[model samples]
Target: MSQFLRSSSIHEILAFFGDLEKTRLQSISRMFYDKIIPSSLQQCFLSLLTKDKFFSYSKEQGDILYYYDIPTRTWIDVKAANHQEHYIYYSMSAVVTDLNRVLLIGGSFDPEFEQYTDAVYDWNQITNRIQPLSNVPFVSFDNGFFYYRGYVYIIEGHVDLFNQSTVRKTARFNVLGNYWQTLPSLNHANGKFNMCAFKNGFIYAFCEQMSSFYRLNSNLLGFERSTNWDLQYIQWERILIKPSVYFGFKMAVFGLNDNQILLFGGDDEFNNQITHSPISKEFSDANALKILDLTDLSLHKIVDDANQDLKIELPDMFYFNQLSEYNGKIYALGKDHIHIINLSKKEIEIIKDDGDYNEEDY
Candidate 1:
């Protein structure tokens, strides 16, 4: 039936709804496209606020992922952690996979010393908890992590706190089987590296200290049809981008467009790699934005019109983390300011989270 059978009598419950709501419900749910009944008073109406403009803020609470609604401009809770013992560290790494799952691999709670980051967490959107999963075979802090084709690949760093050893180690966790397996290690050890999955079924990886772009094949078989993947033929081809040794600063890497990757705010100042203490906020300066062109394997620093050369207006107090992209805009989130960078137009709109970060401060 295209139209609702409306009755003017008070017994008709749906008459309470105006003509528009009735038509809307009819188009949304088939229940509204029915004849009016007198005794039936129970029905379900699905109603919710729009979330497209909401920005996800990964707050201090590791378990809970907060969303800042742009329209309301309020910090709202998206989800919270259910597990207690599992450490949701400020040092942790996470990825939102294709399975509609948000997963965190490892992190440490203590700032001075690393504590309990080997376990995996699956954030339940409904429960608002980080459900702990199987542990990796080893522990790490300065690792590179990314999700692709139903698996989480980890580039291991810092074998243990006591060992203090940095070596090329790689592994993968199968979400379907809930298991972890070691893969072939890289040619060199890396710290604070960026590993992002591309649409072309390859990973673009580089450590903060290297100028080479590593294109890696997970070598997993049957990944399209199964949760488990094969790692017998894993390989990495290092493509040298620049020979000047412009090290990668510690920052979050996000996908800009189909052909380029956006490397947002980072700093050259290195923190204690061993301790992983004194987070980026402690740094006195932030770095310029970089875009990695996939087609030519070239990294270009974005230059602002205000600056004469290749430098943008550096917000000294700004430190970007949890880089998130939405509607063709890359949001560089910090404690005090959110720098919304538009790549195509080369524009930046800085929204102060708490204190105002005026260009006069820089």
Candidate 2:
């Protein structure tokens, strides 16, 4: 048994345990499960063991909410129990807060309207019900959305479709108060940029088009000194180092730690010029996984053991891909597969979604 534990691959060990009785393998599985199972399997096992779930609601599937059951290898649709008003919102931003709810932010509700929406909704995970929350002061879509402390922040994004103009505006929604307040605007107008907040009280925003990076100190001391306790004063400062330019849509960015950020797959717009629009024929997906070191503003491409650039394929052309971190592993949810990324190991395991749950269903 000792030799089997050490010498056997995680998959092999799992297979061996599968043949044994539950009573015989339960304690053993608990003991070495973290090592005996692959990272993807570990995610599932941990989800079951901890009763913690990662919820996902795609813009393409605006009405339905789904969570992956890693152990069963299935996407379970927990029907929104109280979602009576079905409105299809596209290009929206979603953030899962610490309060076990998802806040869906600004998006275009209808293409015919040609107007962006400021509507916000809180979807309860436990009740599987969605309730309308406070709307944003400004209407926009394709914005940078994040949740920090007790507030939900939205950065620059497309504001007007007629002129194709973007905004540098920043705003935060107080979750507890259900009120929206505009914060200091960015120096440069940007849309489709990536933004994330760190526990260190700094919010980082990166625009690939302009090769610009900005950091805003959200702490009371940092804000008071910079703006004299004035919320309307400009607080965003352009960092000295800029991120490398990469043009794509629906790119995923998440902070790995206080000093590291991981950027994942997106639709490579330049490579697939024919499909420039979301409604185009064929979309090209960029697979490069890059990590930006916040300490030095150094961006490096992540590669596998073979010294080859690691890639993640985003199969869904219409929906924005979701990248989430749980239990130290990054989970990239594409249309067809879930890529379980073990950054520490520099390894990624792709698990194909169940065939029955296709895009057409949405």
lDDT of each: 0.52, 0.58
Best candidate, lDDT: 2
Q: How accurate is candidate 2 locally (lDDT)?
A: 0.58
Q: Tens digit of lDDT per residue, candidate 1, span 1-362?
A: 22223222322343235335544654744454444432232222221111123223253444456655444445666656453534435435655543235676665454445555577777765577667788777775556676655577777544344554445667778776578776655665445444444445566666554446576754443344343433345566777744423333445567766787766444454443424322332232235566788787787777767653232244422222345555666655554566677766778787766422122322
Strongest candidate by TM-score: 2
Total clashing pairs for each candidate: 4, 0
Question: Least lDDT summed over 10 consecutive residues: which range in candidate 2?
Answer: 273-282
Across 1-362, the per-residue lDDT of candidate 2 in tens digits comes to 86545534443333223212323544575558556544444443334334344455655555677776554557777677764344566555566553234676665355565555667787766587777787678765566777755577787655343454434777777665578777777756443554445535677775434345677877642312132346454377776434334535556676777788887545554343222123221223145677878777777788888898776654332133356666677776655667788888888888876522345533
Error of 1 at 59 (Å): 7.7
Q: Each candidate's TM vs. the true structure? A: 0.65, 0.69
Model 1 bad stretches (over 4 Å): 1-65, 70-73, 78-88, 108-115, 157-166, 219-233, 245-249, 269-286, 305-321, 353-362
Residue 277's lDDT in candidate 1: 24
RMSD of candidate 1 to the truth, in angstroms, is 11.3
Error of 2 at 49 (Å): 12
